[model samples]
Target: MSFLDKAKDFIDKHDEQVDQALEKVGAEVDKRTGHKYTTHIDKGVDEAQKRTGEGDTRP
Candidate 1:
């Protein structure tokens, strides 16, 4: 499998941890760039995922 595919599989098997890790990553990016767009995009994706009940799929 490609690296991204393996990473996605690893994430699906450990979703909560992966979600938290994603949050932390977005936060760190926000910190480094002094831009909130990434955070906003992340939040929008989360909201869309919740609405669609497609937890692991992209929004």
Candidate 2:
């Protein structure tokens, strides 16, 4: 099993929690930067989710 495969499996099983973690991390980064790099941070998070095959389709 490759790392990507393992990650995909984990994502499939823990979708909600993973989403929450991503949101929290994004929020923390925004907070630390005093919301200066909000757009960049959001883009990074979206890219991360896309790379993980999760997409940005969640509500």
Candidate 3:
């Protein structure tokens, strides 16, 4: 499979870990920016989490 496919499979298997990592990264970005972009960062994180395991095309 291609790199994107491999990434999708990995995310499908470890969605929770991916979500946690995204949250941690978002929080760090917010902290570094003095919370100025808190709302935007949170929205981005939410969007990313929503698409975590959606790549599964299995029956």
- TM-score per model over all chains: 0.51, 0.70, 0.87
Candidates' lDDT values, in order? 0.62, 0.79, 0.84
Residue 32 of model 3, lDDT score: 100
* The best candidate in terms of TM-score: 3
Predicted candidate 3 versus true structure: per-residue lDDT over 1-59, tens digit per residue: 99999999999998778888888999999999999999999999888888887532212
- Per TM-score, what order, best first? 3, 2, 1
- 1-59 per-residue lDDT for model 1 (tens digits): 99988866776676666555566776677777777587585785476444332264433
Task: Please identify model 1 stretches exceeding 4 Å from their true place.
Answer: 1-6, 36-59
Ranking of models by lDDT = 3, 2, 1
Q: Can you give the lDDT of residue 50 in candidate 1?
A: 46
Which 10 successive residues of model 3 have the least lDDT summed? 50-59
Clashing pairs in 1: none
Clash numbers, per candidate: 0, 0, 0
